[model samples]
Structures are given as C-alpha cells and as structure tokens.
Target: MSSVHVEPVIAGAARETWLGGSLKAFREDPLALLCELHRASGDVAKFRLGPKKLYAVFNPDMLKEIMVTKAEAFCKGGTFAEIKRLTGEGLVLSEGELHKKQRRLIQPKLTRSHINRYAEQMVASTLAHLETWGDGQERDLAVDMMKITFDIIARTMFSYDSKHAQDQIARAFDSINHIATRKIRALVKLPLFIPTNENREYIQALRVLDDTVYGLIRQRKAESSLEREDLLSVLMRATDESSQEGMSDEQLRDEIMSMFLAGHETTAHSLTWTYDYILQNPNVEEKLMNEWKHVLNGRRPTVNDYPALTYTQNVIWETLRLRPSGYVTSRTALQDVEIGSLQLIKGDTVMISPYPLHTSERYFDDPLTFRPERFEQDRMKELPQMAYFPFGAGPRSCVGQHFAMLEMVLILASIGQQYRIKRSSTQGALIPEALLTLSPKGGLRATVHRL
Candidate 1:
C-alpha cells in the first residue's frame, strides 16, 4: 500500500469567495479553471462552488489515497451524483456492497475473452458504417464517430440491430447529455417536478430512455431461449454465487444503461480527439499508417493482431492522455476521514481532473505537444501509477476498459486502412467543449479520402 504524506499547502491556492467561489470561472471554462488552479496552487488546492467545498486533488499519491488505499471512505460525488438521475443505481453511481456485487456480476462479461469476441463486431460495425461514406466526401467527423460507436455498442453488447431504434436512443442520449451538462454547471438547479421547458425535455428524454431500455429487457426476457453470446444475454443468465439468483429487471436495466452510456460515449469522444490530434501532427499520422501497414498488411484488424499493434495502441493512450473524455471525476468523503494532513468533512467533495495531471510538466516533457512515442514501453514504467490515467484507477475505474481499448484500436486501424480523415482548412480552430465529456466544439468537420 502506498502511504500519502502531507505536502504543505501553497500560500496562494485558489480560495473560495463569499458567494460561489470559483463557480463563475468553473462554469465559463472548467478545463482552463482547473489548469489555472493547479498552476497557482500545488497539489491540494481548495476552492468552492456555491455552498460546496471542493478540493482539487492533483498529487498522484493523494489521488491514490482517495481512490485506492482509503477508497472505502469516499463515495461518488459532484457530477456523478447528478448523473444518477439517468444511471439510477448503476455501476457508476452505486455504492458499498451493492457496487461490489454489481462489479462482480458485470466484470466477467468484459474480460479478455469476451472483449476478443466484441472485436469482431467492432470491426464489422465499423466497416458496415464505412460503406455509407464515399471518396472525397465531407462530413462532421464527430457525428461520424458517434454514429459508428453507437452502432458498435448496440450490436456488440445487446445484439440490437434496429437502425431506427438506435437513432431514437441516440437522440434521447443527446438531449439527456445536454441537460445533464447544463445541470452540472448550473449554479441553481430546478427540481424535476417543476415542469419547465428544459425540465419537461429532460423528463421526456428520460421517458424515451427508460421505455427503450425496458422494452429491450422485456423483449429479451420473452425470448424462448436466452443462450446468446452477447453481453445482455450473458448478464441475463448470470447468477449471483451467494444468492443463486439472477439480477432483477431493474438491475439489468441499470447495468445495461450504464454500459450504454460509458461504453459508447467515452470511446466516441476518444476517437474524435485522436483524429483531431492526428490532423495536427502529420508525422504521427504517417507513423500510424506505416505501423498499420506493417502489422495488418492491408487486411482487417483482429484480436490476434493486437499484440503487434503497439504503436497504434500508444496513439490511443496519447490521445486519451491529452483529451480524456471524462476529464474530471469527484468523490465525497463518506465520513470524517483524514487524507494526508488535510481533514475532510463527511460531505466535502474532492475533484480529480486528469487533464492537469496528464499535461503537467512533472509527468511528461513537452506535455503540450502530441507525441505517441512518449507511451513507448520503457518510458511508461517510469510514470507514477496515478499519472496518465485516462480511464481512471482503482475499484471504481471503468468496467469496460478492455472493451473500449480494443474497440478503439480496431476502429482506428479499420478507418486508417481504407480512408484518411483530414481536417478541413475552412474549419477554424477547434475548441474543447468541457461538458460531461471533453469533445471538439461545433463538431470536427473533415474530408474523407479513400486510400
């Protein structure tokens, strides 16, 4: 176990104001605000948002204490609490024994063997979606990334194949994500019962989500035999070792919904950001094509090829390091616990944003530049465990990490094999929309050239 030592709080850490301390800055630009706070203060910067006390944790050892060593003393807080409205008691929001059990139940489905099976669908889905594109066609690459990832997750996880149904769920996700992001940054939150236009839109979106998910559950349950290999079927068939019973309909819904949100959303944004970086660095793009050619040899990617695709994997890691989709995650102290020398109250929220830690000069040389070689084997072993955690760390880390990684590699290689997506010269500087997920602002407009 790693021991956390208290480092002296820097004299000029960002402080809370009489009202909403730092909330205005956070709302205007969270990424910039977090970066500023870390630069101004050292590791443990204390600030505020309205009545909430927030400690922006940047030190890797302290992060380990909060996420791993003393993890039991904290529960999901900040935007995670707000997301529960959509996720319910899903893996992302659940706590204590329930979280443990849910993790046990779902972990097996995302194992290496299961992820290998998912790769086939991932490639097929990408290829199928690619058929819709043409040589020299211009498209919003962000939208393209989302649609293909949505399709991949739908087929690979649930065996769902209805394009119409997929589109409906995608639209609902858009509405829900928009409202959720607004609520996260909103100084004042309106209760769901108020039925304001936004509230009503939120409610309707929830209705659509619940209806679609439950309808799938009901439809799956009604099947004569539930022996399929998809994640949904496997989950439906899994029995708790202690209880010798399966999950309830509601439990399945929560897990499935969790997967739906985490499975596709993070990967899509990652691909978007990866391409954005690739467009910025021509040498990186050429290296990627060379590696793909050497390993894949103008052929489709497979699970067997993963080991040989080291550089390709490094690109994904570098992209994730630079623009992690879930840029910030938070945890509230579950009790009066002492982390390092700082005493945290039961409800004090500790915000952990990966952007600062990932981009810090302490972690990487020339941190602002996009360099996949930084993740090369020998260099990776020297970094701290908590450094460069794009998918996060500890027990509460992403459940479908393997699934996401393989999916990213296969999709990137597949796309690179057949087409080159370049940024449009007319498209001005891209901005990072620091919503729930960090994505390219106004979408990434680019031309797709067939190779």
Candidate 2:
C-alpha cells in the first residue's frame, strides 16, 4: 500500500513567511495589514498572530454567520479578556447567561424613550464646552470633544457634576486606557500581583477609578427613595424579571466603568474625525450646514428633528464608515464550525474589521473619497446590512446605539450652528492611533470660526 500524506486543514498554512506570522505586519500597521489580507484572500483569510490562528472574514455573509447566525459558537474572548481586566464583567466583556441577564436588565435604560430624555442635556453640554472656545483661537478638538462627551456622560448618567471629581475621573480613566492599550498586544504580560512599575501604575489607576465609581454607587444607594432621571438611578432601581434581583456593587462598578469608556471615548473620536473630514471636504460642510438650516431653522436641534436632518445624519454615517470607533472586533470559536470552505476548530480567533470593508472598491464607488450622499435613501437601500454597521449588529450589538446616535447628532448640530472648525496651519494631517477606541493621534488642532 502506498503511504498517504494529508496536509492539516488550517494550522500550518500562513500568508506571510515571517517568524511571527502576521504579528510583525499587524504591529507595524494593523489597518493596512488587514486590508491587504482581505484584498488577497477575499472573504476568509487564514493567518497567525504569533502562535494563535486568526481568520480574517471580509464578506457580509461570512460576517453575518460569525456575528449573528453562529454567534453563540463564537464567544467574546482573546482581546476582550484584556479589556475585562478594566471593565470586569460588564456588558462588553461578560459571556453566556451572565451577558444575557445583564443585557435584559440594562436594555430598558437605553430605550428610545429614555434616550430622548437625554437630548436636551447632550446639547446643553456641547454648548457649555463651546463657551471655552474663542473665535479664531486654535484648539485641539480632540481634547475639546473628549471634555464635552465626558461632561455629558457625567451629567446624564451619574448626575455627578463636580468639576474636581470629573477631572480626577478623567485623568484616571486616561491612565488606565493608555496602559491597557499597551498591555493588550504585548508579547509578554505580567500578572497584576507582580510588583513591576507598569503593574503598579495600572493598579493605582484602577484604584482611583474604583474609588470614584464606588462613591457614586454608594451615594445613589443612600438616595434610593429620591427619584431621579439619570441612568445610574434607573439601573439602581432596575430589577430582573426572572429573579427580581438588582445588580451588586461590584457589578455596578463594572458597568459604570464600561459606560464611562464607551459613552465618552467612542463618540469623542467620531466627532473629532467628523470635523477633520468636514474641514477636508468643504462641499460636505456646505451640505451639512444647509441641512441644519432647513431642519432646525436657526433653532437648537431636538430629538424630533432627527428624521428631518437627513444630510446631517448621512455625514455622521460616512464618518463612521471611514473611521469606526470599534474599528476591528474579534471573537473566538467555542466549537468546531464551518465558515464557508474554512473549518475553524475550537479556540480559533476570527477578526471582522469594518475598516477594510468600508474602504474597499468593491462595495463602495471611490471608496477613499468622503461623500455622505452614498447613504441617501435609494443608495442605502441597495447596500448590504453588514456592509455598514458602525454600532455593530446581532445580539451583541451596542445597546447604547440609540443613546449614542441622538447624542452625536445633537452635538454636531449644536456645534455647527454656532461655529465652524478648521484645521490649524501648525498641525499636520490627522492620524488615527487605534487604542481601545480609534482616536486622532497628537490631537486635532483647529481654529474655531464663529458663524
């Protein structure tokens, strides 16, 4: 009998020949490497990150299969594990039954009805932040955006408005975000118990955040009889339908930290890029301004104006496509599964990046160009659902999507109504540095022009 030779289905094959597989390429420029791989391999591309196997899924159908249809088979693991260190068992990191229960409990707070109540506060916060800006004065919109979003989240969610407390929380959160981003991709990671300088700093940052969050929770608990409109108050009052149980203090802390990160960082990055792209494309700004004029008519935008503000919403959509806050999200296979022709065994990691898909020539005409008209009603109807999901899709989709959309629209409208931000001559091109959230590197310096 002749000896039979068979090649392994997925393990040994690698697109790159380097010792570290795609890690070296990914480390250099993650977005570029993923885009290259998608172009070369089509929907599904198998590669390695160090010793781990990763499948880059580019097609809408394949993405749907992983994120929606077979979502249970692919759990939030790997990179999320790193984030869990900061967020604990919050909605973003929790898995299985715990995740479902948490979602059920939190869903009501983010409902459109509840989110509508926050509209006035969102615009007020933006206007308040704009007071710090001067006409013709150069300012970093990145910092300004962060400050405004942070202020909004603080006032709307926690009902905490002390500037000193907000500043302390902001500083500690920034420290944690910086250290967590560095540690997420590091080849070697030391445990928290280890007394390394980096570990010490990370722990201290965690301590500051915990202290602040715990203080808020305690204050809310003491004021249980007092009815409030804030999210924290709602969450404190929330009870599970099945168990009739409320969240614990630790659970509250985790969810608060998750909210602080998600509610602020992502929207701030989106607005910063919105201005960057708007400044780069004068036509876009003109259209946006025209839409605001027609819709709002010199009045501040209300939640009711969203349907009328089509072009303004379109600009936000286009910006999200070009620069998504959650640029690349991943999941690990919990069991053997067949995604098209590829057989992914248990523990295999699948990366689905909207960046490559959004920028691809196949799905978009002149993909590199910034044209918000592509999202017009007729055009958008023809596009696939998975092709443009800035807030993500499926059961694991962002629960705060409604809240975020309304807040972004209000802020953008409020800012554009009073001022036009142009890039400063001293600042170079805006560069994206993919941290926990995709943020503009070196901040976005621009001059505020009063209308």
Candidate 3:
C-alpha cells in the first residue's frame, strides 16, 4: 500500500469548486459527462463529488482488473448501495461468502438446460401480448416491452398467472424506480422514516411489493412437495451444502425481488432499444426479417430455432453493444492497489461506464454506427474482451445473462416475423435516461404493421 503513489487528477480540477466541477453536468447527463472526461483525460480520470473523489477508468485492461482479475479488492458501490433498499441482501447486493454461496445455490437453476424449458412460456407470453396490438395504433413500445417481459417473468419464474398480481408487481416496481432515481441524485439524503410525501409513497409501494412476494413464498412453502420446474420451486428446493437448509422466507423474498427487478427491467429496456435501433436502421431490420422468414417461415420461434436465426442474434448483440441497459457499473476499492499505472486507495470509488467504452473509437470501428455485422464470428473475435461487456464480466457478471439473451432473441424473432415497426413521428431524437436501468426518455413511440 505504501509503495503506490497518488495518481494524477484529471485536468480542470483546479477550476472546480466544492459544488461546481463536473457535478452540474453529471447531474444533468452523466453519460455525456463521462464521455467528455474519457475523451479529455484519456483512460484514467479523477473528479470530485463534493468532498469525495472518484475515479473513472476506461482502459479495457483496467476494467478487466476491476471486474475480473483483482475483483476481490472491490465491492458494489454507488448505485448498488441505493438498490439494496429494495433488494436487501439478495445475490445482487450480497458480498463475500454470502454472495458466493447464494450464487452457487442459484446457478444451477439458470443453466442453459434449465432456461431452455422456459422458452415456450417466453414465446407464448410475447405472442399473447402482441395480440392486444392493433395495426396502425400508436403504442409506447417501451411500456409494451416492459409488460411482455414482466408477464414472461411472472409466468415462467414464479408460475404466477393472475393479471392482478402482475399489475401489482409492475406498479410497485415503477414506484420504487421513480423514488430510487430521485434519491440517488439528491445531494442530501433524507431518512426513510421521514413523513414526507415521497417517503410515504415509497413505503406504501414497498408494502404492496412485499405483500405480493411474501404471499407467494408462503403459498409455495405450503405446497413444498409439489414437483414444479419454475424458478421459485427450484430455489425452494436448493439446500446450502454446509447447513443442509433451504433459504428462509425472508431470504426467499430478497432473492425473488432481486431477480424480479433485475431480470424484467433490463431485458425490457434492451428489447425497446433493439426495436428503436432496428426501426432506425432498415437494412438491419430487413436482414433480420429475412432470417426470420427463412428460418421460421411464419411459424412461432422455439429454442430449437435459435441456432438457425444467426442474423437475429447478431442484431441483439449489436443493440447490446450500442445501448447496454446496464450502462454503468461501479465499485469501491477495498484495499489500496495499482490498476495499471494508476494507484487507487482503499475507499476510492471507481466507475466503469460501458456506454462510453462501447462507443469509443478505440474499441470498435465506426463506433456510433448501427452495424450488426460487426458481431459476425470472425470480426467479433478481433476486439478486446472487455470492449463490449453489456452484462459485465467475471465472477459477478449477471447470472441471468443466458436467460435474458434467449428471451430477447425469441421475442425479436416472434414479433419481427409478424410485424414491421416504424417510428410514429419523425420528430425529436430519442433521449436516453439513466433510471434503475438505461431506458428511453419518455417512451418509444411507434406503430405496428402486420407483415
């Protein structure tokens, strides 16, 4: 620790005040600020948020170190701390031994073989939702994707079929997300116990969500002997080797809530962005539809068909590269360490903004272009490993990555086979907002045309 020297601060730090600096720009649009810093200061940059100093690392090697190689020296920080309020000590928020144990227990359930069984449900839910869309009717495609994904998660993950239950969970998530963004951006924090209107609403929303989740847990426990393949049942049956005990009711709630929030929101936003980009790029859409036509020939997509839909998978990979739903991942240094030439002290916060890295000229050729062909086998292997980590990398990478990708590919194939979506209005450009996940500002407005 003593051998490491203080790293150079990013230029312009001298002109920054306690409240000024990059704070204003960051508050307004963090993505823009990060891009600017990466461009101006090169790979490693440092800035202050009030009294605390933060580091932004854009170098692919450094990112790999922070996320993979020396990952043990870091812990989830920044936004994740805020997320803990909703997910508690679930796999997403847990650390050290608990995270390893929980991850090990849950890993088998999301394996390719296990997730393949959910493919039928994914296609069914997506097709059912598309039935509600009438031709020439303008719809918020973002919200529509959200509903479909939520429905898929409900039916396949928990075997929950009641529309009322789905609606309750969706509304609760919306409320929680709204409050989370506000709290994360606020300069000063307010105690949750405060009787303010926002705080009160947060509590109410939490209560609704808790009631729904806990009720499901109780119901499942009552029927523990049933043979079910749903995620909830699998988790209920998962016994920790050391203790030979399954999770408690509270732990079950936390894990379920974590998966619900993570699985549904990120996938929905990714699909929304994928559609937006496809509509914006006709060639890609044409190629995708051609593949679907060649493969499915107007029939529904299934897990077996995924292998033949090569171009559709490429489009999804491209969308993830351009507009990763989990755009920014952060960590706190647990011990003083050297990341390349830069030295980080214990307690230093490090931010890895994949949004900028994916768009940077250093990694991809014509980084801003919507080119799916870049993901072709030969070309994709040409790039550095960490250059396009939408789901992150290493031990803590998203556990549901396979499940999410399969869902996206299936939904795209099913919907793309049936309709051609076009932007309803050629007005303003779509704005990206950082909420719980990266989502289009307002909603993606488009009209569905039956093919």
- TM-score for each prediction? 0.94, 0.93, 0.93
The better-scoring model by TM-score among 1 and 2 is: 1
lDDT of 2 by residue, 1-451 (tens): 1111111112222356556777766655677778888767888888887777788899888788888888999897877777887799988888999899888877888899988988898999889888888889999888888888988888888898745676677677778777887777666778889998988888988898888889988887887374886777777877877788888898889988888889888998998988888877777788788888888888988889987887777778888988889988899999999887778899988987898888877888877777787777768567777887888889999998888888888999999899987878888777777777777888888899999
**Residue-by-residue lDDT tens digits, candidate 3, 174-272:** 888879877877768798988999999899989998898898888877883847878788788888887889889888899989988898999998998
The global C-alpha lDDT for each of the candidates, from Candidate 1 onward, is: 0.84, 0.81, 0.82
- Top candidate on TM-score is 1
Worst 10 residues of 1 by lDDT: 1-10
Off by over 4 Å in 3: 1-15, 224-226
RMSD of each: 5.0, 7.7, 6.2
lDDT of 1 at 245: 93
Residue pairs in collision within model 2: none
| Model 2, global lDDT | 0.81
lDDT of 1: 0.84
Q: In model 1, where do residues sit more than 4 Å from their true spots? A: 1-17, 240-245
